[model samples]
Target chain A: MSDFPLLEREMNGKPLIYLDNAATTQKPLAVLQSMEQYYRTHNANVHRGVYQIAAEATDLYEAARGKAAAFLQAKGAENIVFTRGTTDGINLVAQGYLASRLQPGDRILLTVAEHHSNLVPWQRVAKQRGAVLRFLPLRPDGTLDLDVAAREITPRTKLIAVAHISNVLGTIHPIRALADLAHAAGAAVVVDAAQSVPHMPVDVQALDCDFLAFSGHKAYGPTGIGILYGKKDLLAQTEPVQYGGEMIDSVELYDSTWKPAPWKFEAGTPPIAEAVGLGAALDFLTELGMDTVHERVQDVTRYAYEKLTQLAGVTLYGPGLNQTRGGLISFNVGSVHPHDVATVLDACGVAVRAGHHCTQPLMRWLGVHATVRASFGVYNTRDDVDVLVQGIQRVQEVFLP
Target chain B: MTPNLSDLYRQVILDHSQHPRNFGSLDGAVAVALKNPACGDEVTLFLDVADGVIQRAAFEGHGCSISMASASMLTELILRRPLEEALHLNREFRRLLQTGQADDPDALGDLEVLVGVKQFPARIKCALLSWNALEQAIEGIDGTGGNPP
Candidate 1:
């Protein structure tokens, strides 16, 4: 916002407490300015434009695709496709690949801890293709039961889709191990990295997954922009789920030929401005260092987990107190409903997410309709946790009595 | 400025939420289970109807303060009102929730403890979940899925 000066406000007659990072992170000033600069000075459609502004916008847009590819450590930008978000990306692969390949009697393996976005699309496609959908069980503490996953990944399994880090549980899975196992079984794997990408460093090639999906909003960027990193051969072989302009090689009265890999998958105009914002976010993260971000989140989550349980009636879920997890904790206090917990916290000017968090199956597995989530980001401090703990205690006092 | 917590959590309101009145099943009475699935707040409102009048009303479930307190207050007023009056009360609630205009705020009395719930739009559902269930029960409908609408 260089051209447009930014503004900040206080809450509770104090500085605003923002702890809702897992839901959507607040973009840094740099990200905001990059977006403002692009819109103000170089506002134009990309790829199909011929004017000076169009070329400039195209450079920024294509540069963003290249940057996203580099961030994900993919070999080429062609393997990176722009999607609406993680949900859209996974839905693309499900419709494009599963519909064409998976058939009757084929088994599609998924973990019980997946978000509804990740779980539902595969289930819908599997049922339509007459495939049997199976779950790779979960542990009491909410981590996936790897032994159960092994047993479930049988010869009939044609595809496997699992979350890299569960949105509800916050447990980071052995994605590479799962990918190797799926490949050994002659099945492809799709990794839902929506939770992991924001909190940890990711390299899709090293992870060896067929496809990986994550959203921009969670990664300190604008919404409606996401990255889908698919292996080159697989992306080429799969059909485009969405048909529109910029995706066709040539069109005739009788028939049309589709483009290759990334562009073929990215139908319509794509999220141009939002994609630029994502690129800027990635650069900002790189400057701060993902390792440091992950470390900071881990430090804060562990602190909150230890201290939060000290309050009476406080309950915690997700990875173990010591187990490495994404930067959030989802839990409930006493018999206080999550909505009540959230409302009371809001009254104290502390924000937290309260709902199924789009992981309803995980909610059912945990035997609760919803849980309040407090997630940390690079911008968050230990003071935020103090506020959360203090606020939660207040909720218990209000509800328990 | 920090909003006063006491404004939302009055003692009388908290009392009603903690020890809700007329809270049990009246067997063979029409019931509707309405839940704000977003927050796991559930309440099953039991309607005891006789001669097209709401003879007695009761609620049995758990939720937030606004939710439980409103249900307790709802049972108290809905008991003596006729079927049409209860429907009208529902309309007034739907309106007063948006604009604190009530021709008979004293008629509502301590039930007006719910008026401040209007300030928090998200919690409005908590205050109205029971009333919605009551509406469904009177009209021969079940809010949650099981049988058809």
Candidate 2:
């Protein structure tokens, strides 16, 4: 508990019960120190200078890439491209990889449960290429309808993009099965692992996804840095979206040759300090063991779901207790807006996210405009859920009265 | 409830949220739709202007108590007032949300209760949603348009 120093703070007059883990996790002391140490000792442009500090800085940056590659069980650092975040990574794939390959009348398969980050990029590419967008529907409980997926993925389908776990519903999709389906149809698979990588073990090779993306901020590291893992062959074939310093192999008067794969994608001075912080975050989680972390969060989330269910007028979205879910729950109190609920809960020192949560289409499909989400992390405990329950009870006393 | 919470959600606020004034569409009224893209809170304001005075004002929307109650109270204060006066009140209301103090407390009337919204920064958008729509409606009329036909 002391590892995360922010938990000691107060909201209103009470101890803060931080449950907005889905939005971003609170950083630990190790990550903070790692970033500070980088600036204090080894602040230099990476892969540029021959000086000692520059060499060490470059080493730290590349080492972070190695850590990220191992974290996702990719082939090597060559398979990992450091990106701004999940949105930037997905946009890279959309513009750099898919833009040239897409032909008129080709189809891109997606699910209705995707975050806007995953949906909007593909929408623009489809529009530009005169391609059609096909959607896979969700079950009543918010799980992906595999039957519909079978019908949607045809020979015309050029790409299949889906989230490994729905950020709104916490429904873990069958990515491996979907990959097999896409492979049979000759369509590439792109998995938005932003919500999955932070909470569970994610092996891109096991999933056999062509491309995978996740953000470091959600995994208790600094913002502005993320990883986009693509198969070595696919990355080699794709062109660099942005070109400049560091990424060029040779510069000529008329034509410049660009570097291979991940370096070509990086383009400029990368996020060095943020990469160091992310590496430290991965080390911190590795020390804890991902399986242990996942178990703790799942237990806490299940306890919260149980407690929330017992309350009358509470409508929980996604699967019930028997079914597996990620470390979050979305629900709404009867006739009470999520904004009001969030405000009242804030006064009681509970922090939860409220609103569309960047999933407006999913909200519309669920016949709701918005929802309140309470998400868990490795640091959350049963006592925090108790405080959240009390806060919600206070909300009922105020709004439902 | 704490005094701050009580001050934020007074009985008057609850009443107005439950029964918003001047709700529904006004026939032959100029309409403007506004959405707080962050939260999906929406407001469609309708105004009937006759000879530089606001003859009628109504709104239709769904949001939290603060936003809905603010919309209801806005229609009550702006109806039958000159366009300039309504715009002045809107400015004063925005000032109250921006800073803790309103220029003239008495000028706000029942809307003065919303002055407590200054404490909660996030809810300030909710309280100002309809007011923003009101501004856009007037600006649309004053810039390139004339009075309601």
Candidate 3:
């Protein structure tokens, strides 16, 4: 065994219990070390330098883009544009692609289970462009009532943006089916894979979505870097929203000709170091093997749902235990506010998230203000779930018994 | 490592949570209601005050054991004390939530259980809900030396 500190140092002197990976992951030393090594060894700007340091930086930067593209099974490196994060990536598409394309009568379709980052961008674009915004309704089980989603995708639908996996519900949406239906409606598909990419196999080609976005932090990488995967031809068609340094080709005083594809989309210095960190994080995930991570999260999520449901005070939300959910579960203990539940969990050094989780619409759908969520990761063990279960049982011993 | 949450939620708290003292309203009396809307903890206090003495006090709300127990114990503590002294304890307990220690012990027994709540940070509102309502009632009745009621 490696004699290194477990990353639970933030738990404040009690037993180290971490369950907020869905919010962001605790960086393993590999990611941290890669970032540190980058800063220590070669710290220079990329793409526009003749020096050896600059050459190294540029090569690594482009290599990171290639790694990201391959991870998503995108067509080429040109299809992967580095951005601040998934929200920035989606906003870019909304502003660059849909803003100009959407007309007054056109419809933008989405699901209520979408995080605010995915929901609000389209709303702003729709309102600004006078386009009609429509939502796919949710079922009692907190899934996008897929039947309704299918029925709602009409001829007027221009672009369908849906979460690949719901952050709040932990239910994996039918991305493949949704993509097929959206394409049949003659609409483009944009997937918010922020929750999906880190946990499962995401072949954008297989899902057949035109574009996909996911954040690095949610996938155990540095916070600021994310990948926006677009089809090569579609990326060439969309205009670059952000205009600044490093995303240029021929510039005259009167008019400028911007670069094409990935470079055109990545404006300014870009999260260069963070992108390098993302590459390292990808390397770490590769070492663990994404398939193993997928299976492990599935097992853990199922175990969590089952264990929490069997407990007397707890109520499981989203899909049923051992069902087709992803790496997390959101639940509420009886009569206890999620905030209180999290607080007691914190007292026991069991850190769980307790809030709407940025899915206010989904919260309203579930008839809950918030819920105590325990998300799983590769580092998580059966012991962690047991700790959470025992903690909740202690809550019963404390308050109910 | 396992954390024993039994240390946090004592049986006294469960006793109060299950069978809250002064559980109903006083009908015609000074009432003050407050809610921690962020977390959905609500408390409505019915104080039967006459001749500047709290004759009886009761409450009803939906909340966690901490808030409910705090409400139950708060009612029991202030039942017969002079309105001004009850007001004093309310102020003192609020201070204890912030400072985690207070000078008054006789007026605060198991009430000390929630003093540890300050450590949790997010739940200070849950622990302080009833005490805040009690303070509001005292302030409303006397008006803090403003106009005659």
Ranking by DockQ: 2, 1, 3
After superposing candidate 3, which stretches have Cα over 4 Å from the reference?
A1-5, A8-14, A250-255, B1-94, B103-113, B125-149
* Residue B60 of model 1, lDDT score: 90
Clash-forming residue pairs, model 1 = A1-A33
Model 2, runs deviating above 4 Å: B1-3, B143-146
TM-score of chain A of each: 0.96, 0.99, 0.97
Better of 1 and 2 by lDDT: 2
Candidate 3, A108-152: lDDT as tens digits: 998878899999999999999899888888777767666888889
What TM-score, to 2 decimal places, does chain A of model 1 have? 0.96
Can you list the residue pairs that collide in candidate 3?
A: none
Model 2 error, position B123 (Å): 1.0
What range of 10 consecutive residues in model 1 chain A has the weakest lDDT sum? Answer: A1-10
User: Highest DockQ, which number?
Assistant: 2
DockQ of 1: 0.56
lDDT, residue A365, candidate 2:
96
- What is the alpha-carbon lDDT for the whole of candidate 1? 0.83
TM-score of 1: 0.93
Steric collisions counted per model: 1, 0, 0
